[model samples]
Target: MNLDPPISSSEVTLERLDPLSAAAARPVTTGAALLALVLPPLTLLSRGHEVTQPLWLIVSYAALGGAAWLLLDRSRSTRPVWTAPSAQVFQVLLMVMLVTAAAATAGANDLVRDDWAPLVVGVLLVASTPYRPAREILFWTIVHTLLCAALGVIQAPSAITDVPALTLAVTGSFSIAVMGFAAAAYARSLTSSTQLWHDRAWQSAAAAALEHRSGVARSVQQRRVSLLNREVVPYLQRVVNADGIGDDDREEARRLARSIRTLLVSDVEKTWAQLMLDDLVGRHPRLNITAVADDPDDLGRRAVLERRTLLRALAAISVERLSATGLALRLSTPEGRLAVRWEVATPRPLPDAHRELRSMLELIRGLTLRSSVHELPGRLVIEFEYGY
Candidate 1:
């Protein structure tokens, strides 16, 4: 078997858009969206403090809601194209705005800030893990940490003087950064492992198929060698052993030469249509198998296999159920499509002939782009159209 052509860049991109990866990434995005939705309200309720700047708090909640909506919208898309770098940058900017808003809300009110917004920002970073590179993740994580810290310093300068408050701001932002890095690392590792397994499985299957084909070729070669020894070699040996040339020996030699010529010609590759007709006529000596073709060499390997399978099924039906003594195969290529028409004559209709034909036709339908089976009073016709 020949190896397929090298994959194009577009093909590689399409493969990267695996539905499994999209499915796995969706849950992470959805979870981040949910956290974004739930965490701010929880923080407000727990703090039990009046929001001095209600409008800023509203803006903060609106930003968080917008981020959540964006992520949820991307998750809904089949391919999840939001994992691109530009999209990630836009999302991270939104997260930064949300953090700044939260810090402003803390500054306006004398509330003990819990750093929930920064933590949620860290969680939102996981949404890009499936598509973005590790360096990109690391870069965004550092950017987010610095942005959160700067917002904290600007919004709550008094709180920064207290040791515990200072510790909370620094540690909280760095801890979130650590979590983001860990999530990105894990996602990358999982993707690598899954791809590795898929490649190994494909290679294993290809090797097994190649081995099976080699075995079949060896078997065919052995049979051909045995046939030559039995039919041609012995006659030649007898002629050589004889003391003198005779008319009888010459006649025998002529017959042997014809046999060898026929064998050699038959060994040449023939179109599937020709091969099937020869095989069917040989198996059923009384049966008439006619094959007509135009440009049979244009047929692809897959088309040939499909034609052979259909012929085998028809042959089996003729042998087992219908006493069909005649069959015709017409193969033609028109407008880049390969079309095959098969006609078989039935002497008398069997009780289950139509049912069996329908079943066989149904199986053949999968092998071709278009196929149809028709039954007349005493004949069945199958037409198949396929592409290279």
Candidate 2:
């Protein structure tokens, strides 16, 4: 899958959750499909308590569930497969199911009334399927709290048992209030999870961006290396040949060519150094060499110098195409006073086939740690006091 920004608020919908939405959506549809089973029994039990009472009610439940399932099922196959907006709708439906069940239970003269069957089925649906349908699990969670609020309001008249004004609302209002609190807690959890996902997505995007830049930089450096190797060096050799004719002159020309070659090497090294520094600055803009060191301690200065040298070396080695995924370099002070450190990244969960790579990184880390430096995939650090 191609990395994109993240799921924003606008894209939070059932339509977004398409395919797996059906996994959850199926229950709702099935509930509606099976509503036919519920209505007949409820109608018989109600025994004519108004003409279309249980008939319309059961049909409505089935129809609502079925319609929602069908619409949601058709929209399956979107990237996320579940959106925040779709979750809200699912949460609302669950609350309705719960409240309707409670109401039917409360109104029933007999505890085992046949009408209670549908409510039982409804509770099973609520408990088993989801509080929220798809990725909108959290969004639905928020809506569940809203439903609880509504339920509490509906049950308000039952608050005072002895008061004629408050009959059906007493116990249920308190129950709904408690359910609301639970829903609120759940909503908070969902919020945290969603935020975490977005954070990860952004982090991945940043890594991808850096990787792209690294690839481009590596390509440019390789081209420069090729030009130096194939063209510049040969041109310098020709210059040496033209000047050198007699034996004495030939010796002088060879010496001059050698000096020119050394100069060329130094120039190429400096160019590579600049490229590495540029890449480092791009990756971590906050690294302030000035603020970090005012009066220069030997150890601090050496560490900075070693890092700079390693970065340059890595840039130079990146002239090889396939070997440029990432790099690590071990460095210690010239006096050997400080611990050694290295930076590295590879196909994490390092493959068994790459025993050499595994050995190299492990050896580097172990040796560095022996001197009190720690290095890992994302960061590296070294401390001078090794014994502690």
Clashing pairs in 1: none
CA lDDT of every candidate:
0.58, 0.39
Candidate 2 lDDT over 242-284, as tens digits, reads 8545675567557756865775674454433233434553454
Name the regions of candidate 2 deviating beyond 4 angstroms.
1-52, 67-167, 170-181, 193-216, 239-388
TM-score of each: 0.48, 0.35
lDDT of 1 by residue, 238-321 (tens): 868988889988887788778767766754655545554554565666755443333356353345333445565666676556
Q: How accurate is candidate 2 locally (lDDT)?
A: 0.39
Could you list the CA RMSD of all candidates, in the order they appear? 12.9, 18.5
